[model samples]
Target: MSKRVASSTDDVASSKKAKIQDDDDDDSAYLEEHKIVVEGGDARPIRDFGAFNEKARHQLEAAFAAPTPTQAISWALALRGSDVISIAKTGSGKTLGFLLPAFHKMEQKTVRGACSPQVLVLAPTRELATQIGVEAAKFAPAFAVRTATVFGGAPKWEQNHQLKILGGRGCVVGTPGRVNDFLDSNKIQFSLLETLVLDEADRMLDMGFEPQIRSIVAKISRPTQTLLYSATWDNKVQKVAATLLRNPVKFVLGDAGTKLVANKDIAQTVEVLDESKKTARAVEFVAAREAAKLIVFVATKRGCDALCRDLRRTTKCDALHGDKDQHERNRVIDKFRKSKKGVLVATDVAARGLDINDVTHVLCYDFPKGTHGVEDYIHRIGRTGRAGNKGRSHVFVTPQDSNLPALVRILQDADQPVPDDLKQLAFTRRSGGRGRGYSRGRGGSSSYGFRGRGSSSYYGSRPTGRFSSSSSSSSSGTKIRF
Candidate 1:
């Protein structure tokens, strides 16, 4: 529980900045198609795995039909003993990316069943850790590998027993808090650890797990390969990477094939409504879309509860958040996945790690904060438009969230579109007056203006009326409601 405050020494600070720049360059190069391709295809081919250990190669062949881009990069680097920080979009097979390396490293270390975990994979959430464990298990048997997972919301005794039994013979996947607990109890040893993988590194850093992460990393011996992976690499991650990794090879799969840039894959539209009409606007928005499956992400737990209550009363919806029990969370996810046009309200915790496929639309009920929050926003939208399928996303933003302009700028720099009204709003802010709002269609009619919809008095205090929604997908039914 000890905190490791970063010292502001001039040399250290400068060194960190230099590392970030280096990482940016490396990432840019890695994002190009040439660097990502394995054997002449958009996705990495399976033949690349043959270069690794025979058992590892066999497992890769049997389990993965083809190597995902992330997997290909991780496997290539791990085999060469190079450290890596992978930043790729969600559903890009990032789990297998590190798991393959861990398996190979474990096999190389194990002898006569005297295996100790040579690799440790840390994730921000138990669901993500468990997901990695499950994927790892599929390949573990091929090489006689064993794996154990430790996380909160589960019986520690059972995890302890599993750890005791697996004891270095396999890999250990767990959340920072539980893993730190195990390390502190001396139940897990880091002496033989060869590789450390931090999945969803941004989320870990955002949730204030840096102290625990630093503590755990400090315990691990040096000369160990460290892999930091996330959807996006912000300043915080760059700082951690500088402290942990040694000139790590950076791989960034660009926003291509990602629905984010075009705002097309997932419908990127916003509703400007006042506080009083916020609930009603959201309800109407959802009703208009009538998406096959929906995930509504709110900024707070109370927001989630209130939205869910209103949705259920006015429309069909369910809620999921940190306060919900594991059973309920699971049930909600299951229902959301199974039911067509189903809607679920949740916090950022539900943003990443939960793999509910076939989601058609993502609704941002509130503006997200921080780079991780934005990445989580991407992850939420990513829930739909998965596996080459088309999806839509809707973001509800009010005037209070003036930061939206900056976010739009970031997205635009990444080749994503910014709504014309958003641009006008930014202009108006610079001029210190409310610029005229843009309408949806011809001649800039004020019909779609943010006034006198559900509430007129809610203009600056709240948002009213519909915004623009654009589709990048080939689907014909994609539409934005005003």
Candidate 2:
């Protein structure tokens, strides 16, 4: 909760500019082919390290058919005990990128004593912390690694018991506030800490957990191997990396610039419209895609609840936001993940680090606004198009949105077609002209329709035109509208 920056070592801060070494290794072809840019040190791209024991290797190979690009590069540097800064988009298997290395270190090292954790993973949100725990649990039994997760909203007594059972060895994944609290209360110790992983480092900083993170790191007595992973690389992340990591190797995918962009696998469609038509339009879109699992993102917690209520009338749906307790949020995510065609209406709280496969559609019922609006938009649409699977996102833009210029750039960068209406919205702001109202009405031409299979174009030509719609009907013989 402290807003102060992390204390930086003067010597390390002086040499914070990391060394660049992308194509100098024997596996340069592999790195180049995958478009992976490695910075900081001399570690090479490792195709398969054979570092994991037979049991652990088998489990990993079974769970993932092959190592993702993020996993391959991360394992190479991390296994060698080098401090690393890894930047990859969401759903890039970042959790295992650092986790497997932590487990590998545990295989060779021993813990200090009871209630002492060997590895600690810090996340910004409980959903992400719990998600990392889930990933750790998958390979824990195979590697004889015990894992515990702690975050706010969960019972302290329960987490304390979990830490006691974990004892000297194993990984503890938690949010900064909860982890810092545990450290202060003497419930957990870092005496045996061999590795520390900061998953989603940018989100943690954005959520203002820098002081707790620095406090937690300052408590460690030894030079633990540090690995920081994030979606985008910016000055803030770079500054934090310098203060925390010791001469870290920076591994990045895509443009390592500050401009945040969405994943290429997601086909994004943006529609500029009136605010009042959003609810009806969203309902129509969901009804049309009744067979696909969807995550509809809203701006406010209240909006999340209301949208979930509306969606439930057409199909099974759930809501997730900060207002809901941890238990209820977990239940909703669990239920949504299990269902084949369920809808999850949520706010920005569910935007980052929560991975769920089979989410085929994302609807921005409410567009992101304010300072972090662009990042929020990228993360919200990123909920789908995960694990190399193609997904789709539809964002409803209104005249009131001032972030249209940023939104247009994102769409253009992703190679998506920018609608004329969206360009006008952005142009209106730039040219100092009064807003020309967007169109609104009842039929296919009046609304931006959802395009089903065999449709020529998703957004059609303009905002007001004949957009494609699914002829598929529900079991009750009612025509699905979009």
Candidate 3:
């Protein structure tokens, strides 16, 4: 009788194992069909937005044809009141991914009074804070929600007044520094907060806002739903997530690493040219596509201004950098957004969070510096190819750039052709003939100096098949000498 009982138990266990394998296969197929990956738990993407409230559904249907991968997956998880961590590319409609859930949570809960917001969104930069405010304005009215945006560059009195209006039982979006200041002054309170979001969370941590973020979260004094959206993920982000989140579900849209993967939507081309030839190439490229909206990134404030002057002589051009005041920066961005075609020369400040639609081209006049060069390059190129629109990026490479091996990998991943000269440059540098670095003058002059035996020999003659300047010169009737 004991042996018979053991046989029965084994049969039951086998049945259960078969069922588990079948369920796993179904889940794998579902995720593959939707082209998404989820971790920590099984969270399915929503195919239809019809289940959302009327107001939210109307906005979603009107604004977009359907939900993006991030939105489809994030909406379902966030609505379930689960802590969520989203790792996706920039311009993937992340703002709405968190905002809609936060709005729904607010609607379901009892409304509170002045200075007590139910939802709080922390951004890294003033520009990003303001942009979030703009996005919130579109949906807040439909939800009967009020929004108050506070940032350091704006007037404190105006922000305080806005926060007090409508009982302040709504959404609050601001930078960490300004939000902390308001909390310290007793102008804002988070005791009633239910939803907390960190948009561009990686950037905020990079900017040293961890302490302020912690301080603000500590004020809540209770459990709340938290969401973190970022372009890249690494140990630092993981540490922050571990401390703040509980039983969170993570959604990684693509590869998750310290470096941002190259965006496939943008066709990237790397040109190995002398530093002195960048300005001429930039001007010619813009002239070739006179009506295309372009954003050119430089390394320094001084260099940004100088490049802007050169571009302005031929077409509409503006400069934005840290040196510019808040008002000036806003005006420059607004103008660039409204114009049919123009050029905006800026530094790394505009790389991360600023979203302007219809940008057709991005020129990297000065590649980003430091350890996160690949991440910065991806962000700069992301400015174009937004909202499912196709775009192009042109990068001018010199021997001075230290991230060549990594850059080559980016090209290979995107299936873009690697230039012969770029390969030689990387190999030569790796083999120990270090080239003297190049630097730009304040005036963007062509007086750059370089030292080393192979400084000018590694790069071959400029490729002429597709990237030839012939078309550019013919249209503008101005020849550019390489």
State the TM-score for model 3.
0.84
lDDT values, one for every candidate: 0.67, 0.78, 0.78
lDDT of 3 at 348: 89
Tens-digit per-residue lDDT, 1-482, candidate 2: 23343334544565553323334544777778777887777557656637789998887667667777888889889988899998888877778889988887887766557888889999999988887888899888766789999999989999999998885467999999999999999998888888899988988998899999999999999889999988878788889999998989888877534468788889988866545455666777788887889998887776667667766777778889999988898888888877888788887888884688689999887778788888888888888987768889988776766688889898898898887767866887788755644333334243333332343212221223222222222111112222
lDDT by residue (tens digit), candidate 3, 286-339: 767787899988877766776677677677789998889988998999898888
What RMSD does each model have against the real structure?
13.0, 12.0, 8.1
How far off is residue 51 in model 1, in Å?
Answer: 5.8
- Model 1, C-alpha of 87: deviation from truth (Å): 2.9
Number of clashes in every candidate structure?
Answer: 17, 1, 0
Off by over 4 Å in 2: 1-26, 434-482
Per-model TM against the reference: 0.72, 0.85, 0.84
Error of 2 at 356 (Å): 1.0
